[model samples]
Target: MPFPFRGFFLAGLLTLLLISSVQAQSVPTVIGARATLEPWSDPIEALGTLRADESITLSATLTEIIAQINFSDGEQVEAGQLLIKLEDNEEQAQLRVAQAIRDERRNALNRASQLLERNLAPRAEVEDTQARLRQAEAEIQALQARLANYRLLAPFSGRVGFRNISTGALVTPGMALVTLDKLDIMKLDFAVPEVFLDVLEPGLILTATSAAFPGYTFQGEIATIGSRVDPISRSMNVRAELQNPEMRLRPGMLMEVVVRRRPRQTIVIPEAALIPEGERHFVLVIHEEEDNRIERRQVQIGQRRPGDVEVLEGINKGELVVSHGVQHSREGDNVQLLGIASDETSVRELLESRRGQGDS
Candidate 1:
């Protein structure tokens, strides 16, 4: 090898190293957001079922032929309103006969009393007539009481379901006649894991949603909590009451329930800022001094929401964090901030905007 050739080779190698160092020093552009203190709530989610506040299946207590149907199906009825009538011709005739016998006995007793007072009749004969009058009066009262059963009355104010029996149909004892539901308020029943038993209490506010009504949320409060937890499922039953003025929520509907336990101030950051490496999580915190250098810090994460995550440790309020271009950032690397994300921008919206830019 010649001396001149060796020197030329060394000079070329030094030029290449200088160019690589300059490229590494150039700042990489990234989008970032500042850690913020926000009101955070922990939500307990569970599936629930809706029920009527009051419901019953109306049935007949006696076997009788229906003579008339007083109410139409699905009609709203007030308490004590007559809903059906059975054949009562025989009961009416029996009542009339008992009344006639009662009148005769009363007249005989009065005549005997007057004779005894005038000294024309013995006191023993007047006493026998009085006893007969009392028995007749008892029969009349018994007959009247039996006649009242022939008409069926509503037990409470509610909406009636379709009647199963028509006019002149014979209905046996305990046979279902119709269904009544009190729909002004709805009862929501749900079960929660036993772990949450300590937090369960009456008057906890919750929001419910059903597939039947998309995007509509029904608000309710916890009405009761079960005293005992189920051993098999390790869950406790909870009941909540919701006012249903529109009557749109029906019984047996499956609802998604969300109970916000409590609110607290916590350090929150955009979900995009998190960098997961196996079991550990990290974020790139940017320092504005000295050409905007980035520092990698491990974080302890807590509850996660739609577009943000709760930072339990390793982060502070008002610290700049790299939200976008996290994959391209390295520790101690200089970065140029393209934009500082507003607190209102969600993780989903941020992802969509990045996707759109990639597509263009």
Candidate 2:
């Protein structure tokens, strides 16, 4: 080989060795997370069924053919409105007899009083007449109550179910007349794992959607929580109230309930930066400013959100956290942020992105 060729080849060989040495000296890992202030309110999921706020089965007070069906089946009835009428002609006649008897007793009692005052009638006769008058009045009231019951009236305002008897069909007292339910407000009954029993409370906001309702969702709040946990199922029963002004929701509809807790500002750290030691949590945080440093921070955990855990203490917002190679890092060490190759935040972003796609 000529002198110039040998020189160039030797130079190239030296260059390759230098590059290899540089590559061997560096190690890179993905650093997880971006600094974010987490809001409180963790996401909770549970399954349940929709129920009516109020439900009742109606029965007749008298045994007779539904004489007159004033209100149609499945109609909304107001409180105390006449819903059905039994054969009340007999009741009306009975009421008239009672009234006449009462009137006669009253007049007889007045005459006996006047005759006693004149000393022509005994006081016993006047006392007996007074008792008869009171007895007659009580009989009148009884007949009036029976007469009123002959007509079935709505006990409360609600939507009526289908009628079992027609105008001419006979229905005995306490028979299945129909059902009345108040549906303006609906209830959702569900159970949550016993592990989460302490975190749940009344008035917690809940969002629910059902496959039957498609894209529509119902918003509600925890109305009641069971006092005791279910021993057999190891779950807690929770009830939520949702508005149904349009009356689109029905009883017994299945739905999923999402309970959201109260929101408060909290410090958050990426999951990759967290290290567990003896039931305690620690995070590797990068010290920013003069002479880059690293520290192992003991952090208290609170409500956890997606991809991150809320740090109740030991970390602040906007702090530089070392999420990569945290296991190998020690506290009070000189660390350069760029020296470690970072892929941690990107991995989380990628997983979240794919999750969004799957959900859609």
Best candidate according to lDDT? 1
* Candidate 1 lDDT tens digits, 1-360: 799999999999999998998886665778889999998878989999999988998777788999988788789899999988899899999989989998999999899999999999999999999988899889989987887788888888888988667898999889888888898899999999999988877888889999999999999889999999999999999999998988889899999999877758999998989999998999999998767799999999999999899999999999999998898889999897776788586555666787798799
Candidate 2 per-residue C-alpha lDDT over 162-219 given as tens digits, one digit per residue, 9 for 90 to 100: 8767888888778988788888999999999888877888888889998978889898
Query: Lowest lDDT 10-mer window, candidate 1?
Result: 343-352
Question: Cα lDDT for residue 121, model 1?
Answer: 100
Per-prediction TM-score to the true structure, in the order listed: 0.65, 0.65
Off by over 4 Å in 1: 1-40, 100-141, 263-302, 308-360
How many clashes does each candidate structure show, in the order listed?
0, 4
Worst 10 residues of 2 by lDDT: 336-345
| Residue-level error in angstroms, candidate 2, position 128 | 0.9
Global lDDT of each candidate:
0.89, 0.79
Model 1 TM-score relative to the real fold: 0.65
